[model samples]
Target: MPRADFPTPVKNLIAELKRLPGVGPRSAERMAVWLLQNKKAEPTALAEALVLAEEKIISCPACGFFATAEVCEICTDPKRDETLLCVVEQATDVLPLERSGAFKGRYHCLGGKLSPLDRVSPEDLLIPQLISRIEAISGEMEIILALGADVEGEATSNYLADLMRGKPVKITRIAQGLPAGGGLEHADELTLIRALQGRRDF
Candidate 1:
């Protein structure tokens, strides 16, 4: 007989839930119980959706975003400014920018930034593909490197800037500084420096 009172299926569900990011064992247990005790239709629907997405979803060939088709919607959108490209660390990053409506340009998800300690290299990301895509697009395009502020992101950005130097395209990095809603008191030295470097005439 099993040591625990809960059924094996419930235990298994909790174990699976624990695998999710930021979900601890206790939280997973609570979620599992909630799923089992509540209206069963929701869990059934969720499971079906997860399975369907897993089976059908694929990485967009051009931009590395998630899509059911070969190309993602943003990549195929004709209205987006082709002369501007915003590069992000992941496909998930693309959605937040899209939600904020801050950028009206095309995007390229690098899949991830460079991390030598993690064994992530330039080849691991979509750099080669990005170059090819740039070549395909006409006009003087500005490649916006919208990577994170961490060490790996910095390394990756520097590598990209060096690679794109003297090329036909204009390579520009996303500015790091005091956020619009943030105060100057909380800003770090690097942030202050970047703010000055990235500053434009008001």
Candidate 2:
């Protein structure tokens, strides 16, 4: 019979890794073993990187997207059109749209959508900031609601539309009947851009 020995520290590391999203127990154990077997300073660097990311990275004040500094790169970019703002649920949702090379407007990341069961309220999102920005815009701007076509997404779009009533801005929602409940992060770049181009008024 062969005896097995497992260190407490290694077990702790594996458990911690398993806590991460999409990382199962087997994958976590493999990662922990890899970290131990690798001679380089990668494990230490990985720990440092995780700590740094959590401590330094913050939500952009204006857009509710991730930003290392006070403002996000897109918000500070002068080339983007201020007269147009595309509203999305998460920060990663912007990538597909950006890759399509179709949109020339700015983005407002809501951080998340309206999910009552998830205890997500409008106050929990960046909706107030969006309204303030709309009010402050010197000229009429077009608000493009780019949320997914899920039930919650539809509710969010309707809420925003009602909020923008009497405002000088034009409100629009991305086209439907494509892929309902599909996240922008998962959508192909061409499809997302086409949706943006074919947006309909809300």
Candidate 3:
């Protein structure tokens, strides 16, 4: 006799869950089973929320953060320092810094770092938008690179510093050697605060 297996719909659900980052096939199967079997699990609500987010959420034009409107709340906030711009690798990186409450400046998400091996070039990022923003500012400005501590992050920072060498802005990078673990998403608020406080010229 043939071994029994999960139903087709359950297998589909597990496959979809496995596509999410950090979720393995076994974990996905467990989650799918739990969602179907658990009394408190609201699969309908979860599906609706996912659809709503996909439909309503968008990347902010001015900054690359998630927004439901034309621009994100941070970019429009008058209290945020206009002269200071923090550049990060991704939209998710912004949250940890914001949670730290150590930075009160504006932000620019690069979308991704420069990785020739990965075929991610400067053109693939928001480098042009960043340049335009810097040029639009009349007075002195400071760009704080809050990228990861990896090799690609280092290369991206160096490339940006060189690109903006003659520009009327001070380019600095967040202090390294801290226990970020992997990226800003994994870093604690205290670590982010310390990194911001200890930033240095690039």
Top candidate when judged by TM-score against the true structure = 1
TM-score of 3: 0.88
Q: Output the lDDT of residue 121, model 3.
A: 98
TM-score of each: 0.91, 0.81, 0.88
lDDT for each of the candidates? 0.90, 0.89, 0.94
**Winning candidate number (lDDT):** 3
The better-scoring model by TM-score among 1 and 2 is 1
lDDT of 3 by residue, 1-202 (tens): 9999999999999999999999999999999999999989999999999999999999999989999999999998999999999999999999999999999999999999999999999999999999999999999999999998778988999999999999999998877546645788877776677678777789
Better of 1 and 3 by lDDT: 3
- The sequence of per-residue lDDT tens digits that candidate 2 reaches over residues 1-202 is 8778568999999999999999999999999999999787489889999999999999889987779999988899999999999999999999899998999999999988999999998999889999999999998999999998778988988898998999999998766434777788787766777778777789
CA lDDT of 188 in candidate 1? 92
Model 3 CA deviation exceeding 4 Å by range? 178-202
lDDT of 2: 0.89
Better of 1 and 2 by lDDT: 1
Candidate 1, overall lDDT?
A: 0.90
Separately for all candidates shown, the number of backbone clashes (residues 3 or more apart, or on different chains) is 0, 0, 0
Q: Please write out the lDDT profile of model 1 over residues 16-134, one tens digit for every residue.
A: 99999999999999998898778854898889999999999999999999999989888889999999999999999998889989899999999999998999999999999988888
